[model samples]
Target chain A: AQTVTQSQPEMSVQEAETVTLSCTYDTSESDYYLFWYKQPPSRQMILVIRQEAYKQQNATENRFSVNFQKAAKSFSLKISDSQLGDAAMYFCAYRSGIGGSNFGNEKLTFGTGTRLTIIP
Target chain B: EPEVTQTPSHQVTQMGQEVILRCVPISNHLYFYWYRQILGQKVEFLVSFYNNEISEKSEIFDDQFSVERPDGSNFTLKIRSTKLEDSAMYFCASKGGAGRNQPQHFGDGTRLSIL
Candidate 1:
């Protein structure tokens, strides 16, 4: 079983600044996928970015980037030039990448989530 | 951009009653899933469906819970006998069949309130 952990319960960043949310996971499987999801006041779970365990280079999507350390089992999200819109609950999620009987049916395991607040 | 859409943004049912939450996944998606999140808690996977049958399910998904793709477009999750603890936000997600690693797109979830 894979478990995701987000140690930070709450985080705040000043507008236009940068912020990093930490996440770690314990998985015996070598192949897997990591993702960051954002939930705003609307309560919609939106995918922010994703990283593959095999990729040595981190994944970057505009202002959102990830620091993935496979050896350490750590995957963190960094938001640059943060804006008020970034204020939301962020969750770290994990999914198996192995292909077998459960090929496309792999379920996502999620962390407790970190509340991000952008201060003006 | 194709999106998964869930119906009845909110549902209120009495304990021990049956409740069904519906979702319309992306037209081209081949994988469907149901997940739930209690207020102030992390999202938890319930079940995953593929090829019209359930391929995976979690411990939280007990006998009281069922999933069906009754038609070409609708995917439904039914709780046979709801309990107060079942009250949570139910989310529907779908993924394209092109590859196994494709990200799953999620719907805006239905808030299920069991009284």
Candidate 2:
């Protein structure tokens, strides 16, 4: 079975500063995908960024990026120049690659989530 | 951009009552999924549907829970008899491709509250 862990339960960042949310996972499979999702006060789950285990380079989407260390089994999300809108609960999720039947390779195992607060 | 949409942002019902949560997946999406999160808990996958049939489901999806795609675009999840433990935020998601690389788009989710 695969599992995701978010060590930080709560985090706060000043407006226009940067923040990094930590995540780790345990999986025996070699091929997989990692993702970071954001849930705002409105409770909408939004995709922040994604990283493939095979990719050595980290994934970056505008202000959101991921520091994926496959060997360490860690995938952290970094929000640069954070804004008030970034205040939300962030979750780290893991998915198996294609052709894996453990959970249909479609089901996502999510972390406990880190609640981020943006201070003005 | 196309996205998944769920109806009834919030629902309140008495225990043992039957409730249906609705979702309209993206037009081109072939896969649909339902997930739930209890307050302060991690999101858990409930069921996954493709080609009008359930492809996979979690242990949480017991006999009391069912999913259907009655129409081309509408996907629905029904709870036969809701319990207090069933109160949680239910999220609907859809993905366009068959491969696992594609990201699933999620709706705002319906907060199901059992009284």
lDDT of 2 by residue, B1-115 (tens): 8878999999999999999999999998888899999998999999998877888899999999999999798999999999999999999998887665788889999999999
**What TM-score between 0 and 1 does chain B of candidate 1 receive?**
0.97
Which consecutive 10 residues in model 1 chain B have the weakest lDDT in total? B95-104
Give the candidate number with the greatest TM-score: 1
lDDT of 2 at A95: 88
Q: What is the CA-based DockQ of model 2?
A: 0.60
Tens digits of per-residue lDDT for model 1 on B1-115? 7889999899999999999999999998999999999998889999999998999899999999999999979999999999999999999999987374699899999999999
Clashing residue pairs found in predicted model 2: none
lDDT over C-alpha atoms for residue A37 of model 2:
95
**What does chain B score (TM) in every candidate?**
0.97, 0.98
Query: Cα lDDT of all candidates, in order?
Result: 0.94, 0.92
> Model 2, A17-119: lDDT tens per residue?
9999999999999989999999999998999898989889999999998889999999999999999999999999998885444333388899999999999
lDDT of 1 by residue, A18-94 (tens): 99999999999998999999999888889999998988999999999999999999999999999999999999999
Q: TM-score each candidate.
A: 0.98, 0.97
